[model samples]
Target chain A: MRDRTRRLVFLALLVAMATALHVVEGMLPLPLPIPGAKLGLANIITLLAIYLYGFRDGLTVALMRVVLGSLISGMFLSPGFMLGLSGAACCTLVMALLLKYTNCFSMIGVSLAGAVGHNLGQLLAACLLLQSGAIIYYLPVLLIAGLPTGFITGFLLNSLLVHDRKSGILRDLVRT
Target chain B: MTRADKILLAGLLLISLLSVAVLYGRFSIFPAKAEPVQAVITAQGKLVRKIYLTEGVNSSLVIQGRVGPATVEVDGTRIRMMGAPCTGQVCVKEGWIGRPGQTIVCMPGEILIRIEGAAPVDAVTR
Candidate 1:
């Protein structure tokens, strides 16, 4: 019972942090020359949840962050919100599946997969919504841009995991 | 990073470079086809109209958006979004655009207008 409560509180904390990162990342325009490409700083929290909690909790945290972040940004139900939701959904699912089922990749591999899936999902949304082939070039640009950002996300998550390796939660909950 | 991570990263980079080369090759297929500059407009994911932004041209168009109609005007070689039914009317505030690659997008209206060059934009611009 206590373990479950801990998990719940931790999940809530992850969602809160992820939401804050999402909104902040949206505001701070990184020097990435590509228009829509971003740092994806919130993804670190998603990865953390996946590693510590599990796939379901990880997905919940990710989706909740996007929904809350979009609401906070006042872009509710807008195309930007849709794009963000799609990206978050796809990225989280890909990361969870990679870590849970495959187990072939380290945190970095899963992070890279999540980043690539995120961009691809957003592109799919934009293509279907706008119906313009003009944005096709963004596909390649976003894909290339994913590499550096994914590496950063993966690197950060790894460091955080190492830092927390000794900590309370990892020992409190017996991970499946 | 693990060995598998390196492979994935390298593979993604390869695919990105390949797609860029492929797209550039496809766009340059005509090799300087001197077509006139035009602004393509789409609403509800369908092509609404194409306006050639030639000098001395004056026209007004109304495209239906998700909420209501959006007014667009073309004067000389520039096009501007006049007003939109949506609350923000952010598109209306975009003023005017005449350069290639410039775009005006209204998410609520599901409207997209982009200025295109005769050939695709050069590497630096895009």
Candidate 2:
């Protein structure tokens, strides 16, 4: 149907935007002392997709972003690729579940959970790859960092959602 | 925020505080309790060698790592990576590590240099 096609086109655009964010973030030099810690700016698009569409569509966008982003960055099939995949998977799943089950959590809470889940997923992947639990030491730092980063992204998404709702952009997308 | 959000935030705050407390406790309280005696080298998850770090001793080692060659040097109380084939050379840039629990890892070379018997808690945890 036309509705399905329109939704597909919208999702593709989201994927492209998410990939751009991911690639751009990868280029910046973060001052964090931890090795793998990042702001995860691209997750904003994932959260938006979930809020707009649903879990399946959000997950599709997240996975597509990770894959295509890594390919474009020339890190496909590398350790970084695996880490990104695991983190994005956990982030999307946790956010989707939270959104589905609880109305109590605002987008901020959901974004916080997603960020924490992403860090935990990356930690798990690092431990498995290195065969060392020493990586767990980074957990506290990552968690502490996640709080602020998640809050910023969540705040941005909340404002953006409010504006879109007022403009009827979200409703139009949902209708088509 | 709702009650649920408040609870989640409180829980995360507690965890972060606990982690920071544990890290501080490990570094400040237990540091003087143990002394590091040796440096252990591992490549590809296998033990490559163990070098004793004694005063007035100097040693150097060249390891055939996964990526290429890596060189390590130990001078008296300090140990460091002299050279490595990895692109970043971060291990070499780590300079000298004389403390127990300190580690210099060359990921591309699959080389790890860890100071053993130095601290009661692992450095990563610290």
Q: What is the TM-score of chain A alone in each candidate?
A: 0.89, 0.95
List runs of model 2 lying over 4 Å from the truth: B1-3, B27-126
Best by TM-score: 2
Root-mean-square deviation of each candidate, in angstroms? 12.1, 10.9
Screening candidate 2 with a backbone cut-off below 3 angstroms (N, C-alpha, C), the clashing residue pairs are none
Per-residue lDDT for A82-151 in model 2, tens only? 8788999999999999999989987788988999999888889888988987677778888999988887
For each model in turn, which proportion of the native inter-chain contacts is also found? 0.74, 0.47
What TM-score does model 2 achieve against the real structure?
A: 0.69
Q: What is the C-alpha DockQ of each candidate?
A: 0.36, 0.26
TM-score (second chain) of model 1: 0.67
Residue A132 in model 2: lDDT: 83
How high is each candidate's interface RMSD, in Å?
2.8, 3.9
Instruction: Assess chain B of each prediction and give its TM-score.
Output: 0.67, 0.65
